[model samples]
Target: MIPLDRFSGHANLYAQYRIDYPPDLYNYLLSFVTERRAAWDCATGNGQVADVLANSFDQVDATDISETQLILAAKKPNIRYQLSQAEQTPFANQTFDLITVAQALHWFTIDAFHQEVRRVAKPGAILAEWGYGLVKLGSDLDAVLLDFYRNRVGPYWDPQRVHIDTSYANLPFPFADVQHNQFTIHRNWTLDRFLNYLRTWSAVRQYIHENEEDPVTDFGEQLKAHWGEGEREIRFPVFFRLGRVMDEPVQ
Candidate 1:
């Protein structure tokens, strides 16, 4: 498997600039979960998802491959942070009432991870995995952003990034009720603040490391040229899959 962690070097950037999911998404995920005694947040970067799960569950076990990222993760009394890969874990079988993967699902070897999910999750447990796509600046200023995403730093992005581009539509989810849903992340940010978020992208980090140039600073200039210095509400389109872990083995 390819090294799944690309954000280890910029763990601080991830903790500082990554956008949070919407409340509607949490409500939707929790609605299907009948028993919330214990939950697992796989690939729980920064422990943001686990932090939220801790609010509802008796215990939330969160795991990640990168210790640097986990070190900066959100901490709660009910949350346990551990170093582990997504495809395999140290948790006992039939451990979780709810299993979740936030934006980090694409990093896992899906087939192996799904098998592990089935092994650890209780029968009839709800497994929800979701991720948001490229940020949508207003139509007027988006060109500048797209130029960077598709041109400047595009080649630096990993091949796995295609899954995110299509919003995971083509990714395999061999489970029932794999219902499709869309959620919007609404955030208001000044141009410079938005640039910080862009810096968190794995591709941007790669671009800087490879080329030794700061594209975000240049992109900021392009944006400021278009956007008059003020806060604007930006939206990220979220794609999600919610399924019930079945008793029958996946063929």
Candidate 2:
């Protein structure tokens, strides 16, 4: 299994810099579920998605393997945060009306995670998983950033990172009659803010650890030359898929 503690050191950065799902995307996910009783946000780093679910559901159970990430989770009366793995949770059988994994499904041992989802989800519950791809700045800026991504820090990425690059299309989703939607998560960021966000990338973190230097420091200088001044709208295209959890054996 990938080290669950990888994000622990930078958990604060994740809470501060990670992009949030659009409001309409949350509306779309909630609209499909008839019961708003309970929801699960697996791998709920910083509890971003769980915070939203808390507003709509009676209770939101959020879990992550990283204690530091859980420590930094959003605090709300209805949101219960816990330290747990995605493939095995402490939830009761047939408990949740919805289950969500945002920007995190790719890191899981999916076949095993699917079984646990089956065990906890109520009949006809919705299982939704989504991830965002490469950041889009603009023509010129994108070119620069793409080079930094593919050439500089690319080798540090885990093999499963390919699933996000492909927009989860290549994932072995077992749901019957799967459905999908496209969305964008954007942020207006100053150069400093943008670079700080890049520092939160798992690949970038791995790169810094394996090698004794932070590549983002050097790349930030190059990007600043292109960025000039003022806030730029950074866009991350989101890919989402949802299907009904039914009385079917997990493969």
For model 1 the TM-score comes to 0.97
lDDT of 1 by residue, 148-197 (tens): 89999999898889999888877778776666789999999988889999
Question: TM-score of predicted model 2?
Answer: 0.96
C-alpha lDDT values of all predictions:
0.89, 0.90
Residue 176 in model 1: lDDT: 61
lDDT tens readout by residue for model 2, 1-251: 65445689899998998888999898888888999999999999999999999998999999999999998889999999988899988889999999999988888888899999999999999999998999999988888888888889999888888999899887777875578999988788899999999999998999999998999999988888778799988898999999889889545
Worst 10 residues of 2 by lDDT: 1-10
Off by over 4 Å in 1: 249-251
Clash list (residue pairs), candidate 1 = none
Superposition error at 199 for model 2 (Å): 0.2
Residue 113 miss distance in model 2 (angstroms): 0.6
Give the least accurate 10-residue stretch of model 1, judged by summed lDDT: 171-180
